[model samples]
Target: MQKLRHSSLAIAFSLLFSLAVQAAERPNIVVIMVDDLGFSDLGCFGGEINTPNIDSLASGGLRFTSFYNCARCCPTRAALLTGLYPHQVGLMRNGNSLTRNGVTIAEALGAAGYQTAMSGKWHLSRTQALPDHQKQLDWLNHQSQPDRTFSPVDSYPINRGFQRHFGPIWGVVNYFDPFSLVDGETPVDEVPDDFYMTDAITQKSVEYIREMSKSEAPFFLYVAHTAPHWPLHAKPEDIAKYKETYRDGWHKLRNDRYQRQVEMGLIDPNTYPKPELQGQGDDWGALDEATRKHMSQLMSVHAAMVDCVDQGVGQIIDTLKETGELENTLILVLADNGASPERYLQPGFDRPNETRAGKPIQYEGLFTPGSETTWGYIGSYWASAGNTPFRYWKAQSFEGGAHTPMIAHWPAGLKTKPGSTTDQPGHVIDVLPTFLELAAAEYPQTFKQNKITPVEGLSLAPILSGQQRAGHPALFFEHEGGKAMIADGWKLVQPKQNGQWELYHLAQDRTETNNLAATEPERLAQMKRQWQAWFNRVKP
Candidate 1:
């Protein structure tokens, strides 16, 4: 009789143990970032391109209208991962290494018993080839053997915080023949004939999600894609879908996106009217048949790149749902930077290593890079419409460069208001704090024998809960003297070339078309002082 009583007690304890494990409340996180996507380039965000999977997230979650990036690729990634300003992380300029001081989101979450994996682009490096490095710059100029190669030290994704990472480590690489790619610590050299880089990354991400679902601990996945950024490569089939679509040129496309944006209810109809489109060198009616065809092809390639990213997003979301983890996983989707406005299609430009042994290698840009194939950038006129009603392009401190579409989706925890928009002031630096708050994790003061920089961001838990009002107060922005400052509802922006500061009440004019610099000199000066003080504390 005593034996039977002991057996009953053991059964009860085992059952309770199972229930406790299942009841754990910590949520998984997946932060997906795309490279160089335009603000109005997604269907959910007013772009005419069909991104149903992404649109689903917008329909089921909150879309942020006032989200901001660091205005460039490496800088934004550094800030997003470290929860500190990019300059503080040693990426004040391009090609700087991600220092060992701060704990990245992956490292922090990993310490808190989470599985961390990173895939796709990893551009944050502590060092790269400089002019003094073996005369590489001289070689490029003379087409001689380059003595120095572009190399990053101690800045690989896995080295920083991720347990597993796969993707290109450099800033940009050819989609078909990429450079400096790795899976974990090992370099990947071979790809199947049918291999599309975007599809491959998506597949790997899905597999990672599946494996993590079986683990007792939660997971944090950062999937960064090098799409729609450069070289404009895409599968032939995907390109075919958009071939004839953009033939009408950027003007029609911009209008179409604006109208679609209203239909999706992503933007307020009366909030801000569309800005005038700035015409470029070639008008739609002016270009010859062949030139027009080439333009259409280039635009098609760009669109396909985005479509691939959207498909990948859908795959991850579907995998999470299948494993019953979708409801609890916090998903944040954003772009790394603005659209490429460089004119890569200029005359007399050729790929560096294109011609060899009297054999012509077909290259395709308006001007080609290393080959005879002509390849060059599409100019600012098209890019203006790419960012859609926003001024300037990548590398600028203006909204066109800094502002991006941000979407958050969490079925179990985050507030779900389908088709709703939030104008809350949030920046890439705030992402780490938001995740930390959700996971109940603490930030460390130091890691790996290095003194860590304190995070300079506040948690957005209140904003997500819809309890807080107004964007972040005193938001500061700068990129080598192209500067802007926001305090209260007033914004002071300084254009390039030492242009006079312009003022605007952002709540009333988000497009920044009107310059109130002449009318509000006192307010502009006050805001300028505020920005200077903040920058002094953060800069050398």
Candidate 2:
């Protein structure tokens, strides 16, 4: 009897030890980036959009109230993925490529035995947008073919370190019929009838996760969704829900979002006043009924796009839970940039949807505002509110452009008490360093075949452990000459297209209403010169 009991005890002890060993293995990393999402889009971020999945993550993880990104899409992605400023990575704007100087986060993680994959928009490329040569190229490239296509290498994703790539390489595309998408090296021309771009990206990501689960190596999945960006398209069912909600113009919507933001504690009432709409047309109230309806419909579609993204987040979370990897996965979610205020010409980019070919289409603004056929955007009126009390919109060097919603979740590692928010001002560059430290991975001095620049961000691991570091001394910013410097909580910002220098204490006024440039001229001059010096060293 004693010998039998001893054998049973030995078996139980072995099983427990095996479980412990399995738990000691590294965790998978999933970085979900939403393109052109505003600061107030998510539920946790104080928007009216119902993003329960994302909100759940915030309720159970760390929410960074002052997270920053590069002022635009390609630049933000380049900086977030490469741990360098966008210009340093050669992605200063759209059509810029990832140069050999900086190593991507994928490359670094892959070196540490990570199965790297990326799905959805990959905008890092150096293709020149030449309207004059475009017609000639289309004719020359496809002489006899009805369907015209461009070369892949002009902006392929695989060349930039991701092992698996899917979705459009360009910035915008038809949601129904996407172009420049690939499954590995082969082109994917056909998509299912039930295909929504957001859903497709998520499905492909789920498939990648499943395939990588079989490998002993951990995985790094970059799921970049091109949702909620113009031309915004959403399912009919989803769009119907937000139909009458935005019937009121942007003025009312801005006020509503501001109230919600204050209620959520995302913004302090005493710190910043409600943002006033900028660039609104003088005849905004006098607009015709047709135009008013179209504008409201456009906003509805934008909201639905966000809803679809939230659904995608749900799918990813469910996948991890099903695979028993939820407990050990570190998930980071953020927007590529703040809400874009860019406006594109409507009436379709390609041949207009008309019966006659030689009718000489006049582009009478027939297409809906945010539809794929229109190519128009939700302008600064909506954009200002999209960013809540923040000033300006995308492309501005102010908080409105760079500040974004960032949430981090790690059941195994992040020990910050659940439902906690951090006021630490962090940037996209800090992500790479933080992940490297968490994964116990080292940045390669010479990645692949070329020497790489040292990472500029410090690891935010201390914050994850419910502690704060000394914090960043000076955070730099510049895009199209719009520049700013954040030292402690004071910010010095300049608007694009030759706007004057403005200064504010961010902690006291996050919206940047009080321009301290006149009051604190000496401080503004000092910071302006400092930013210029940093730009001299780092600018591309």
Candidate 3:
């Protein structure tokens, strides 16, 4: 009996050792995505906002200058989650659902034994029907009532392979009192008075991380923050920090950010000349004093939202360190799309005209934004500055709308130099393949017996390891009828839906300032054919 006990103890010890080794081999992954942030919003990316936590990641890892998103919110998320274009996943437009034809990164990694969790906005599905009880709450508050039926169970994050999910099901929500708050499959009807969406999302993420650390298996956490998006909801203390920073106006702000980008080697000042400002010219002095003050306040609120997100990042980093998972963790930070240029408020069942605390919101006239009682947007003037030195804003096919800053930091994985930058052209579709490569996870040919589309992205592992590699032959993009194709530093973009194609040699004129279509007709035709082929393959 004594000999048998000794053998059993030895076997248990060996099993635990094997589990530890496996966990170390597959590093923990945390992908942090922020919404509606411009390319230059983070401090490390040449913006003035305080993003020290995110900046620290860039300082220790690599920053990609030519990374591209889908130029909108839901489409970008779909592409990033699946290793295919958004249209391939049936998300060609904002309200589309994820098709069964594609598998998500979580689904792939979870199948490989990685614990998966997501906290924050899950906008892949259409607006879900509200419960009868919640419908009564909406009616009692004099708010717009939603459809009676709920969203398909398969469309929720939990159904999409997230073992845990805590956030709103819809795309946009009031930061203070969000709609469709869900903890797993159940809806959270009441929230604490101090509950803020950004903070709550981070708190849930930290909790999930801490819990998962107890298990021997590795974990994947997606922290999607809906900060600084719209309605300009920010805490008073955060807003106070930037209330006076934009007093000099956007023209000066744009120039300052551009100069900083050059100084940091993030942009080539000579090759990429600043494009002409989109809306108003660089004449801050001409604006009336009242208009100037209002614009400044709006920007301050926007900056404040970004600041709060950074603070959450700091907390997450601290949690990792405390749990002894810091070194073996891979953290990626990026934005869904460029800065938004939307000027009007679109109130609907999703966007209620009331706060979570039962206060009516005013959408018109000159009222102080960033408060709970008001809804405000930064408009095109500041948006042009937000995407400094780039043309246009979100939803267009221009550089500003599609390009985003991407950061990757992993002490135990990446072999690249610290504080480095890569000019490799990458897209959101590449994210899943990159994560799969790191996790040693397989992208299945079929998931749950449904045939899956093959991944459309190339693994960026070579570039991350300090090796020279040829990237994708060409990247194609189309949204709301606007289309663009980039191949070998030559780009063909159409600003409007079904508009004439304009060509630009991105190597020389990345800003799309000088059109070269007429000069090179043959090259244009070839590229157009390539784009059409791609569109036919992926378009919904």
Full-model lDDT for every candidate: 0.74, 0.76, 0.85
Candidate 3 residues lying further than 4 Å off, grouped into runs, are 1-24, 128-150, 280-286, 356-358
Best by lDDT: 3
Please identify which of the two predictions, 2 or 3, would achieve the higher TM-score against the true structure.
3
For candidate 2, lDDT tens digit of each residue in 39-94? 88787887888899999889889999888998888888888888898878887766
- Of candidates 3 and 1, the better by lDDT: 3
Which sequence of candidate numbers ranks them by lDDT, best first? 3, 2, 1
TM-score of each: 0.87, 0.89, 0.92
How much lDDT does candidate 1 score? 0.74
Best by TM-score: 3
For residue 61, model 1's alpha carbon misses the true position, in angstroms, by 1.2
Give the 10-residue window scoring lowest on summed lDDT in candidate 2. Answer: 353-362
- Residues 260-306 of candidate 1 have per-residue lDDT tens digits of 77776666646556777764476777888777777766777788888
Better of 1 and 2 by TM-score: 2
lDDT of candidate 1 at residue 163, scale 0 to 100: 85
